[model samples]
Every structure is written in C-alpha cells, then in structure tokens.
Target: MPAVQETVDQVRRIDVDQYKYGFETKIESEKAPKGLSEDIVRFISSKKDEPAWMLEWRLEAYRRWLTMREPTWARVDYPKIDYQDYYYYSAPKRKPTLKSLDEVDPEILETYKKLGIPLREQEILAGVVREDGSTPSRVAVDAVFDSVSVATTFKEELKKAGVIFMPISEAIREHPDLVKKYLGSVVPVTDNFFATLNSAVFSDGSFVYVPPGVRCPMELSTYFRINERNTGQFERTLIIADKGSYVSYLEGCTAPMRDENQLHAAVVELIAHDDAEIKYSTVQNWYPGDAEGKGGIYNFVTKRGDCRGARSKISWTQVETGSAITWKYPSCILRGDNSRGEFYSIAISNGRQQVDSGTKMIHLGKNTTSRIISKGIAAGRSQNTYRGLVTAHRKASGARNFTNCDSLLVGDKCGAHTVPYLEAKNSSAVFEHEATTSKISEEMLFYCRQRGLSAEEATALVVNGFVRDVLQQLPMEFAVEAQKLISISLEGSVG
Candidate 1:
C-alpha cells in the first residue's frame, strides 16, 4: 500500500474521541480568585508587577467590558458564558526567573516534548546538516503554558541579529516605548468584547521586532497550552517589522480535554513599515470535545495587521481543526500606497464542532491590492461558516481585490455556509468574489474503492485534494502535519 494511504488507514483505526493532546499536566499552579471583577484584574496586574499605566489601561478595558455585550451575530449556538464562574488567571508555581531550560519544571518540559516542540536549542541544531554542509533552518520557540511563558529559546541568537524576541510581559518592561507606541494601535482595546477582555487580563504571549534591512535568520514560533480546569486563557501577541525587514512567524495551540468548556480569547497585531514583509501562520488543534460534544473550547480571537508604510506586505496562512465553537477573523488594513495583503485558510470541523472564520481586507491607499482564499470542510454533524469583507476606500484609487471561498461536506447531517461582503468607493477600484459548495461524488468513491481504497481512505483522499490550494501556502513541515490532521479529523465521518 502507498505510504500516505497506510497512514490514513492507521489514523482511521483510532477512536474518534481520542484526541492526541487531551492529556493534562499535573503541576501545582497559582490562580487568581474566580471571577471578572476589578479586583481580579488588579490582582493579575500586580502579579505581573506591571507599571501603573498598564494597570490603568486594564482598568479602562475592564470598565468598557462591563458595558459591552457578547456578540451574537455569528451563525453559532452556545450557552451563555458566566464570566464570574471561571478563574481569570492560572500559571504553574515556579521561580520568578530561570537561566536555562534545565531550570524549567520537568513536567512542563515533558508536556512540550510530547507535543513535538524542540525546547532545547542545541539538541535541535545538532545533527541538522544539509548535503552542502550548511545548517538547516531553525525555529525559535516561545512556549506559553497557561497564563505565563515557561521558556523562550534562542534569545541570545536572535539578539545578535537585532531581532527583539521575547515574552510580551518582558517586552512591556524592557521596551516600553515601542509597546506604548504600537500596542492596541491596530486593534484597539475597545475593538470587541473578546479583545477588550484580553487587553484587561491577558497574561503572556510572544513579541517580535525585526530591525531595518535584515531578514530574520530563522522562523519564530509560539506554542500555547491550556491545562488548568475552569480557567480562561487570554494571551496578547504583537509583531513589528521595520523598513526593509522580513520575518515569518508561526503559532500553535492546544488544550487538555475536560468536561466543561474553557475560554481562549487572544489578540494579535502585526505592523510592517516601508518595503517590509511579515508572514504569519497558525496550526490550531485544541480539543474539540467528545463525539457527543460534551466539552470543548470557546475560541474567540481577534487578529489584524497594518501596512504602515509604502510597498509593505502581510500574509496570513492558517489550518484550523479544533475547538467546539470558533469565532475568529484575521484581517488586514492596507494603509500605505502599493501595499499588499493575503489570507489563506483551511478550516475542518467534525464531531458537532462549530466554526465561523474568515478575513477582512480594507484598502485605504492608492494601488493597494489584497487576495483571500478560504476552504472549509464539514463532517459528523458539524457547522462550518466562512464570512468575509472587502472594501476599497474613497482614496484607494487603483485598488484591487480577489476573494475565493469553497466549502466541502462529507455527510448529509453536516452544514457549510458562506457570507461575503464587498464594497468599492472609488471608480478606479475593482473587486471580484467567488464561492462554491460541494460534496463528495459517489462516482469518485466508487473509483477509489475499485482501486483498493476503503471508504474512509477514499474520503480522506478526496478531502486532501479539495484543500490542496490552501495547503500549498503553508510551510513545508506544517503542510505535512496538516494533511495528517485532516485525515484524523474525518476518521469516523465516512464509516
């Protein structure tokens, strides 16, 4: 049998509810009082030893959150989340500072190891050599466990290249000026209910700044893990690329299985200056509850990027296959002349999951261009939606946009939806949108079966082909992992 088909068959044999990342890390943790009061916010801020201004910022966001209502416009149904019933902050009990990975808690390190994260720099770099005797590309990782960053590797190496890579909490302390200038500049604290809550109580996330005229020597990545029960994980990420610089960032997330839903509300901001470029990618695989959908994550996230200088570019690529309820949109603002933005997504839902995700492109400068391609796959009584918006402002003369959304259904009980909005305020602007919905053809399945493929394997093969376009956009290693995940997510849908 072909290797790919063999892998598919192996994955199909696993139980549908056996999420690979469902194991919890047993470690003593420190947590704030249960609830969403001003006092809880103060406690979190004080725990981080944040500046008074930062505290005031959180207070302002908390005040605003009190008046704001949770959005209900998305095509999803869920029980009301009781903010006061959950712990706002949770982190492993550890020393305030660590000099190396050896000092990190063994259980936490083992957790990341099980998740296939390379925290030891020397181990990852060793034995990694090409035929020409050149070292292969390396990835600097920021491992965030629950509410705090457990470790960030390759800090000294990144500093040599004038790239600022660290935890956001450290950035606020070390580079306050930069944080103050750009934090919330793209997605403000008052952007939405989830973002506002994140701004108020977010504990830790990755921060990156690349200097002018330099390309980052390696990929930067962050891995987030939620382990504590009944606790919400709120993280904030920010990246800035100065003039003539380039950086590629990757994000990965997971959570342990539980009987009650947990909350994950995160905010990410990206800024690119003149001639700079930023590529961001995500592989989200949080636990999506059992086959009956008894427990899972409510992932409400806001991510946006800004082209702040002429000729800048920002690209987003994501593979989402988890979460019981996912409400996210990664968008871009082309604010500089000749700027460009792109979004490529592959979303797969199974086992009663609900996903509503897409992107927005806003052109505000002359000659700005944007493109969006989204593919959604639904199976096992799931609901998947693709909602997007594209607009060209009055001043955006010569602006152009192209958008394509496609959905695939694997079973009669599943559903897929597409909702796109487009607007052009200038006569010189042009926009095009295309969408399609389809299901697996019986003839195709018959052909595969005749070729010695089982029903589940045939379905996986067809689904892989359906999402090949978006898969091509991901990094090489990520694409392979995503392909296997796609097969695993659809294991029981066909049989």
Candidate 2:
C-alpha cells in the first residue's frame, strides 16, 4: 500500500508541474480605473482613435448591456463575479511605431520566444532560422498583449497578395468602410450579455479580409497573452472572405497564474461570401487554478460565423484545455442556398475546471448542410458538458444536419454530460444525432503496461485515438501543440 501511495504522489507532482506557459511578462502598462462604466468605454474608443460612428455604436451596445443580466443557464457553477471590481482596460505603454521586427521591444520578443513562438522564422521568407538569424517561409503572426496589438509579422508579404490583415484597431481607422460594412453583420451588438459587453469594451483583436478570387498566401495567426492583474480582456475579431476567396486563421491564448479570478469575454464574427470559405481554429490554454480551484480565468465568449452567399462555407475547430469556467458556443448561420458549416471541438476539464461549450447550426436557406463533432474529457473533480443546438427553419428545404457528441472519463471523481437540442420546422430537413460515453478500459491499460508503457503514456495513447478525428481537422502545426497539451492534461489522471 505504501509503494502504491508513493507512486500516486509522484504522478500527481508531475501533473501539477505541467502548466508550462504560466510565467508572467514583466512590462509597464497603462490601465484604466478598475470598473465598468460609460467613461471607460469612451476611454477605450479614444485610445484607439475610433470614429464617431464607432463610438456611438459602442455606446449603444453599452446601453443594451446595462439592461441585460449575466446568463446562468449553463450546467456549471462558480462564485459570482463582481463586475465593478476589474479593470475594464489595460495596455502596454505605446512605443514608437515599429519599422521592422528588430525594432520591437526585446522583452516582448523574449516573451514570445519562451512561449515557443517561432518569431524569427515567421518574419522571414524561409521558415528556417539561419545561424545569422535570417531565413524564410512561415505563417504570419499578430501578437496581442493584454488590450493592444504589439506587433504583426509578414504583413508586407500578405499585403502583396491583396490580403488586408491587421489589428482590429488599425482596421477600424484605415478601412472604416470595410469595417462598417461587416463589423456587426454576423453577430449583432445585442447578441448576448457578454457579447454586448465585448462590443462596448473590446480593446483589440485580429482582422482579416481576403480579396475576391484570391486564396490567402499563408496562414494568418494571433497569439493573445493576458499579463495585467485585476483586469478583464475583451477582444473582438472580425474576418471576411470575399467571393471565391479562401483563408485559414488561427488563434491561441494564455495567461499568468494568479490567485484572483480574472474575466475574459470576447466576440468573434466570420463572414463568407459566395463560393468562399473560412477556417478558424483556436487552442485555448488559460490558467485553470490549482487543485483547490482558488483562482483562474472565467472565460465567457461568443463566436459565430455567417454563410451569407450561395455555396459559401465556414468551419470552426477548437481545443480547450484550461480555464476554471468556460462558456462558449461557436455557431454558424447558413443563410444562403447550398451553404455549408462544420464544427470540430475537443474539450478537456481537469482539476476543478468546468466547461460548458458546444456549437450551434442554424439552417435558413434551401439545400443547406451542417456537421458537428464534439469530444469531451473529464478528470479529477472536474465537470465537462456539451450543450448544442441544431435548427432548420421553414425555408430550409432539403437541409441536412448531423451531430455526434462523445465523452471520455479518466477517473471516478469526474462527470460528463451532453445536452443536444434539435428542431426542424421544415418537413424536408434531414437530421441525425449520435452520442456515446465511455471510460478508460482497465484491460487496455493493462495491455499497454505489459508493453512497457507507463500509465500516463498509455492513457495519452488511448485519448489520442479517441480524439484523432477532431485533431486531424486542425492544421499541422496546431495539431502538434494540441496533442502535447492533451497528453500533459491527462497526466496523473489515472491510477
């Protein structure tokens, strides 16, 4: 018994040490007074030098947020949040405009380096870093620190392809006409409580516009890091793919460990025109607190995509492994004939983490089609829930929908639940739903152990097999990171 106890202790110690991206970046910042108010919204808009119309839009959203209440319909529990106790905005002090990557703050560069971001290679044409620190061919990156965009790489290359990729703040000023045309077209300001808040106070996020008939030259990505304490992050992302165009965008997030719970509410909207397609992927790894759930991020986000023209398509892929409480539903609206939508997700809840997430597909036009694949893994004393909806309207003749939700358990102390709502108002709509729940088989573990594999290794092998379908949907680079994160999250979860 003593030997077994000691082995368990060692496994736990390793599991607790797996949060590799929890280090803080020490940089001075300018912060707004801690609280939510009209003044704060105005201050954020002023900082960005937004136009009067944009400010009015933000104020209108704020007015709507005031009349709304924080939603409590999810199957998760956490302490109440004091909306007045957090800094609505925080940003690193502005530095002189940068002419090249070398001019970026060394501290900022070091932060990305420690996070495993290939900044040097990404800036060059070749994806390799030579001995002299110059190479080529890598994805473009926009790094967001707290509430502002710090730097964007490969912008010149993307610009040559007629792609407009920049920070949302810059987009608001430089391309106001484009921003005005599609900013709230998909997700209205009145979308939800948190989204309304984000609409009003969102500081900075990525913006991408693919020109007509052009395929993006390379993948555009963003990395968001939250460093300031007592502050909330509200970033808004807008992506538009013009007719016959294509683009793939990826986002990643992390935060420093803190004992006090922080808030993150974001809004993302994607628009795909006729014959165009958009692929959006996210790998979220926020701090999930300690074993006792003392402090972590409370992530409440709203993400939606719109297929507004015939033959348009949009897909969302996400790997969620952290956050004390997560509530998000990335949805798609198929509003044009023959449009398509897809959602692929993998959610992991360890320690005291709680996740209430899924996707929604709304079919409103003839011949629309949609598919959803979701996998949830629960370990320790955590809770994982998959809540999703699929609706076909009266005009959605010949629409088709398919949904599959699967849950895996790592220990006896965890819980997994699925809630799927399907509604079809059109008699011609075709729908299918499949769900399954399973636990790690002792026989499987025994077989792997007999092959000289450790318990953690065996568990990860099984999990990877279970989630292979969704993982394959991610891009190659993101898939590697997602796999490593899955293995680390499941470590020490099994005996």
Candidate 3:
C-alpha cells in the first residue's frame, strides 16, 4: 500500500485579537454622517455642546484645509483620499455624563472584556472569565476603539496625584475650561492638511493634565483601535504638565485588516511649564494591509510639544510599523531658558507600506539644547524615509543640537531616503547631523542562523540590534512588548 498522506487545511483563522481591548461597542452612536460640510462640522460641535467660539475656530480650520492641497512629495503612491466619505463624529451611544465606570453600559464592559482589558485592574487581577477562558494581563488600562473612549483604569490612583487622565469626551464636559484653553495650543488648527481635517471633525482621544508640583506615580496610557472598516479615524490628544510637575504618558494604536484603505489623521500636543518634564511615547501597529498590498490605513498626523517655561524638558519616543501610508513629524519647541528637547524614533515599513517621518526641534531659549536620533527600516517593496528639521533661532544664544539618522533596507525590492533640514541663525549655536543608509548584511544573518535560529528569528535578531538604541528609549514596562511587536511586524519577505 502507498504511504498514506496526512493533510491539513488552512484554518481560516479569525483574527487572533491579540490585544485584549479589541471589541466594539453596541449603541446608536452620535455620528455625523458620511461627508464633510459646514453642517457636519456644526453638527459635531453641537453634539459636543461646544461653545460658539469653538465652532468658529473649527470653521476657520476647515476653510484653511480647503485652501491646502494634498502633499505629494513623499515617496509614497496611494489612491487619493476622499475627505467627505468619512464620518466626522462617532460616539458611544451613552448619555453625555456617565460620571463613573460603573455607570457604563453593559455592552461597553463586554467590549473591554473581549479585548482583555477588564473594567478595573482589581477585577482583571481576579481573572475576568467567560464561558470560554481568556483574559488580558492585569494592567491598568483605558481602551479607545474607533471614535469612542470605552474604559479607563487606575482612575483613583491617577486622581490622587492631581492628574486628570480621561477620555477627551469626559474631559470636555467636566473640564471644558482647561480643554478650551489648551486644545490646539501647540499644533494649531491650520498646521497641516490632515490637522485641519482633524480639527474640523475630530473625535475622542485622551486628555491629561498634571497639576503644579505633582509627580505622577504611574504611567498614563491610552490604547486606540480602528474597528469600522472604510472609516477615517481622526483623534486629538492634548497633554499639559503644569509648572514644576512631572508626567510620563504613552499611547498605542492598532487596526483590523480591511480591503479598502482607511484614513487616520490625528493631532497630539504637549506643553511643559517651568521646571516640568513631559515624556510621550507611541507604539503604532495599524493594519499594514497585506503582502499583496490589498489594503491598509493612511496615517497622517501632526504632533508637537512646547517647552513653555524655563528649565522644562520634553521627549518623544515612537515605534511606527504599520499603515499603507504614514507621514508625520512630531516636533518640539524650546521656548524658555535652559529648556531641553529629545526625540528617538524607529519606523519600519513592509510590503507596499510607505512612511515619511521624523521630528523637528526648534531652539529659542538661552542655552537650550535638543537631540534627534532616528532609525528607519524598509522591507518588501516598501518605501521609507526619515525627514527632519533642526533649527536655532536668532535669540537662541548658546543653543546646541545633534541629529543622527540611519536607515536599514532588508531587501533589494525596497527604497529608503533621508532629507534633514537644518537652519541656524544664532552665532553661538552649534549643531551636527550625521546620516547613513545600508542594507542588512547576509553575513549577519548566516551567523545567526548557524546558531540554530530560524530565518525569522535570525532576521529579528539583526533588526533588533539595529533598533536597539531606539528600543532602549521606551519605558521599562513597555520596552519588551514594543520590541516583540517590532520583531513580528518587521519579519516576512526578508529576502
């Protein structure tokens, strides 16, 4: 008899739902229908019960965005985006004031449970279970899916330090005064094309404030996921560190695989007052379409920070690996005497993905200093670029800036580019920028493979080494997870 064959069929594996906070809510959400118009903008404002001034501000931004043209200079090719085809507002079908977590709807809790983020850390630690068995690690969390902020954990602990960590929606109703003062303070509404769109029809995001002389004890976090396909995600985040305060905030994003490309435009602003320090970190893993480049998200964002007072410090660290099109530059302004700024980033694009990103540092205060370190990795047939700017204004006496950017191409099919712009008008300013690009060497791979590692393992090892500098910059609790995410996202088609 011929040898019998054992066969296995490809199990159309439903998405693994790696992140515990992966479930969608059920409600008649408050949404501005698909389209962009003055009516839609006004509708969003009215939905939020925003005052008249905000409505006028949004109108101005919309007008500015109309005058601005879509930027085509990036080394990216994708279908043109339609601004009108997206919902300007999508909120959880809940009252304006569900003041407490327990007041949340049961459906919302189910969404959190499905995503592995339980309502309270204590509940999670007690092992939240279902008819089937699964749970997320007992970490304090705030889950934001699509356009709504679902849940937040560790609220009392954060509140004790005079820190406000909540969804922008709640903050709008509870702390509108603060939101009105600081919203769009750093990255103005007319900043860029996507920013104006975000301003006009922005949905919900995290809002954080650290009052004067307080030191935040725990890390503040926001987890964002895109659930609805064919929808654009426009979120706005504003963080303010009051005088003599300190805080460390982190945000992560992910999206599902869909056939049609989705647009994600967001704005993040950070402000640090005298003797304050604000550190912001992001690990973005949006769906990067597929190997054949069928679909993915277009990520265009504006992130900037202002060190508004003397001796303040601000730092930004990001690991970007998803999206069919990614274009952003998180920036910093040293406006006060002896202020400091730093940026460390690692961006990877695979398959047909494209990313053009980096940071900008402006020095205006006496003896202000800044540093920029960036690593770009390109794989498959993707295109990746590192574009940055470092400037020292005329009044920036004794200013100093150092920028180092490096690129690694994993295959012959991909392309990498670097464009760093530096301008210095101060006589006392000193700056240096060094950039280089190289392909991952086969010898390095061979050595790792000889040590009994699989191809994927070997590749991950080398790429990890290449990005070690940037990885080391992440917060301790998040560094390991971020590195693992980078490894998995950077694998495949390394030839």
Candidate with the greatest lDDT versus the true structure: 1
The TM-score leader among the candidates is 1
lDDT tens per residue, model 1, 1-495: 133665586586787668888999999999998998999999999888889999999999999999999999998889999999889999899997778999899999999989878788876668566466645447899999999999998899999999999999989889989999999999999999999999999999999999999899989999999999999999999999999999999999999999899999999999999999999999999889888988999999999999999999999999999999999999999999999999999999998999999999999999999999999999999999999999999999999999999999988999999999888999999899889999888899999989998898888888888988988888777777788888888878885
Better of 2 and 3 by TM-score: 2
* Order of candidate numbers by TM-score, starting with the best: 1, 2, 3
Per residue, candidate 2 scores C-alpha lDDT tens digits across 198-313 of 99999999999999999998989989888899789999999999999999999999888899998999999999999999999999998888778878899999999999989999
TM-score of 3: 0.90
lDDT by residue for model 3 (1-495), tens: 010010000011122212222234444566668888888889887877777877888898888888998888777788877777777667667766566677677776666555444566765556767555645444446778677777788887788878899888678778989999999889888877888889887877889999999988777888877777567788889999999999888888877677788889999999999999999999888888887787778999899999999999999999998888899899999999999999999998888888999899999899999999999998888889999988999999999999999999998999999998999999899999998999988898889889876566666677778888888888865676666666666656554
Better of 1 and 2 by lDDT: 1
lDDT of each: 0.92, 0.89, 0.80
lDDT of 1 at 386: 96
The TM-score values for the models, in the order shown, are 0.97, 0.95, 0.90
User: Which regions of candidate 3 fall more than 4 Å away from where they truly are?
Assistant: 1-30, 94-96, 99-119, 124-140
Name the 10 consecutive residues with the lowest summed lDDT in model 2. 1-10
- The better-scoring model by lDDT among 1 and 3 is 1
Native-referenced Cα lDDT, model 3? 0.80
lDDT, model 1, position 94: 90
